[model samples]
Target: MAIPSKTIKVFEELLESPQNRLVEQAVESGRIPIGYSCSFVPEALLMADKLFPLRLHAPGLAGTELADNYLSCFVCSYTRGLLEFAMDGRYDLLKGWVFVPSCAHMQRLYDNLEYLQKPDFNHILDVPRKVNNDTLLWMTEELQMLADKLAHHFGADMSDVSLRKAMEQWNDFASVVQSIGDLRKKPNPPINGAEFHQIVMASLASPKDLILPYILDFKKEIEQREGIKNSRARLMLVGGHLHDPEFIRVIESQGCVVVADRFCTGTIPGFKTIDINNDSPYKILAEYTFAKTLCPRMMEDFDRRLNTIIDTVKEYNADGVVLEIIKFCDLWGVDAMPLVSALRDNGIPVLRLEREYCLGGEGQLRTRVQAFIESMGK
Candidate 1:
């Protein structure tokens, strides 16, 4: 049977609105919502007590006119689009905001937010450039301090019990997402990439309690569905800040199956379950956050990141990799130089595309993807 239209519609409707219906409902139910920009922010910590994490994205953003007043044209469109939304009062419902300096662009975004919006409960959880014992200790301390601030400001329950509970809850959600992601590894997977991307975006945007039931139902339906048999080539997407499911749809429209992805909003690491051990919850979060195969902002983790991409490609049986980065993103632009050479050296086909944060230039994107599939001789 084909995938249920109702299941997909639930996620599609959630994505269309600026403030998600579940998020608005959570606010109405006396839960506080906090806005976060990057994956580096430990969301479970934000969820400690009455706080809920709202991963920010500006879907269907048409222009950056207001954002342009403050940020230069040199800024990446993702940041610009977010600023545009903020200027439009799209995120006014959020009581607090947290940020991590994942890159200079993000740092600039924070700077602009501090000056322009002057949010009441804004804090930056400083993450280190390198993963070492010293940095790990620093990270653990930073999280504890952040928890303390949250408790002091919002009367949040950041006690070990609360933190642990939040972590456990997040892990449960991750387990379900992992099961869905594993389905993609099948020789002919039941779910396609665009559908999978929409599911993930909806999960991240909605509170776990509000969205999990719907996801569980969708997962059950997907598991029993027929496998897609018309895919010409399997691809693993690698990049930064790709929250738009339409981008995946465009790629798949060119006759390839996006089997796996390693991006900011992707599953490989983003939805990986945290291994619950006997360590302090903060320490566990610190270690877990630092250990993931993450973006190139981790200066000393290049080899680890490269290996994760290679391993994922093999694990997913992908014939090629499509690495896309938004225009004017310095971190990924610089990282791409070495990554392209390295992946090709390892006998992996790589197609590098640079586009704006908003989805456009579909004809060109289709052309490039078609060429990439042809190059793979699929």
Candidate 2:
């Protein structure tokens, strides 16, 4: 189905604009905005503290010389692009920064960002390697400690009432996003992969207050439309942080319908919500974030992660699995080949594509993707 033009317009406004209008307005109104990138940063905590949690994105960031000087040329492009965005003065409004360790590159970016004196109030939350009762206890205490620090730094109220309210709101947003994802599970899916990617990426770039209404409206439009049953092959895409929708667009353009994904930017982990009823909200956040996450960094849970991908492939009736690894991402680079072997052994066709973080190299990606689609078609 074709998503509503209005929905596409909304996405264009968020993606094409240099800054998020809602975030920019929030900062201009004397509210402090805290910047975060990784999923490990509990956005509910930031909102509960009365801080605007701006999800950091490096929109339109090309190659960078300034960022390259600090980090090696071998670093992941996403981190380097973000560093360039900050150095280029696009992120001056962010009062504080939160760093969650997905890899070594992010840690180095945090360290160098501190040295540069950008976003002076810095925090690092050490989430454990695996999920457990002990992990939740450890993380909740750590969250409480960070809450104290934020309260002191920003002079904002971090009350239980505020936390409950934020949890309710974030949970509502998650419900809406999950509904959108569930649409893809349908035989003739109402929405295509590229449009869905745009919506999710736009949500990351903008606040839920502004983003939710548009998505809800988009959902209604999607429900009223016809399903796309003409695509040649159904595919499941798996990868690390994928913000740009062009990769999905490329796959879709090659007559493959990407009906399932395990992407950081999409619904593998980010779309699920913490159940907020009669629970310590921080503990709920801790459990949901780590327990449901499918990151390659969570080495101990590879079986669980692999099972999730396999289940998605079966559930969606996918013809193939695309292991989309970023070029310099050490974690996924090691992960892709093994996952390819595993999926192929289970009677699933597999394609491993090395990708740049930004929208570059689509021509090369498209040629390879087209060949994969033809292989699946046969």
Candidate 3:
């Protein structure tokens, strides 16, 4: 079954909401909302505890005057952007936030957020650097403590069964999205690349149950429409947060299919799942959180991330790589030179575009992307 046309329309509409209403609803109903950075956070488990786990993304702020007052110029641009947004009261809706020790810059941001004169519920979660058994035990204990704090604040009790059920539902949802991603690798994929991005972005904001069916239906629909022509050149998108479907649409409109991506808000973050074997739910969540791959901002080793992108592009038979760098994203900007060089050494052409999270930049991006696709054809 494919997602109904009406459902897609509704998903688009929800994205337009100035404040994340879904998050607002979760908080208003006496549920704690914990914002997290990196893919390691087991947000699903938090949801099971009746807490909304929102991924803390870079806020795409216009100025950094406020952030500069607290942080140094050497800090990563994403951290600065987030600080600017917080200062501007953009994410005032969040009840609390969780920050992992992903990088030195991120850790600094956490310190500032914790001590700064702002909202009362903001917090910094200390995550262990290593992934050993000792660390896992420590993390489990930490998560349990955090859970207790949330329960006390929200006046709600979270049972083991509920947490397990939420994990199961999220696992199912992940499987469905993985299936759709797998389909994109086919010579004649069922759904268009742009449409697939829309589905994925929508899933982030919607409930698991609602998202799972739409994904399954979309897969089935694509299967039915097999044998459709696929003249567009295949490409892999790499860079900062790309949660907006409009970005994908811009690339697709330029006659290129985004076969894979390693963006902060794309497949990299959503690809992993929690292990169900652990008897201790907190332990399971801890292991999942700490063992995941680090993003550009989190890890010093750029080569590992570059190699992963190369592998993904190879697996998908992508003809070129598009680095969708967001302007002022220090991590991506720093990594771009080496990443592009590595891909070029492997005989893959790359195009890098610096953009803000808006639609106006599409006109210039489309021309450059179209030229890249045209070059791939030759």
Give the candidate number with the greatest lDDT: 1
Error of 1 at 78 (Å): 0.5
Residue 163 in model 1: shift from native, Å?
Answer: 0.4
Could you tell me the lDDT of residue 131 within candidate 2?
68
* Model 1: how far residue 208 lies from native, Å: 1.4
Model 3 CA lDDT for position 131: 57
Is candidate 1 or 3 superior in lDDT? Answer: 1
Higher-TM-score candidate of 1 and 2: 1
Distance (Å) between predicted and true CA of 256, model 3? 0.9
For 144-244, candidate 1 gives per-residue lDDT tens digits of 88999999999999999999999989898889988999999999898889889998988888787789999999998887788888789999999998888
lDDT of 3 at 90: 68
Q: Which candidate is the best by TM-score?
A: 1
Which sections of candidate 2 miss by over 4 Å?
A: 1-4
lDDT leaderboard ranking: 1, 2, 3
Q: For every model shown, what is its TM-score relative to the native structure?
A: 0.98, 0.95, 0.80
- Looking at candidate 2, what is the lDDT of residue 276? 74
What TM-score does structure 1 among the candidates reach?
Answer: 0.98
CA RMSD (A), model 3: 4.0
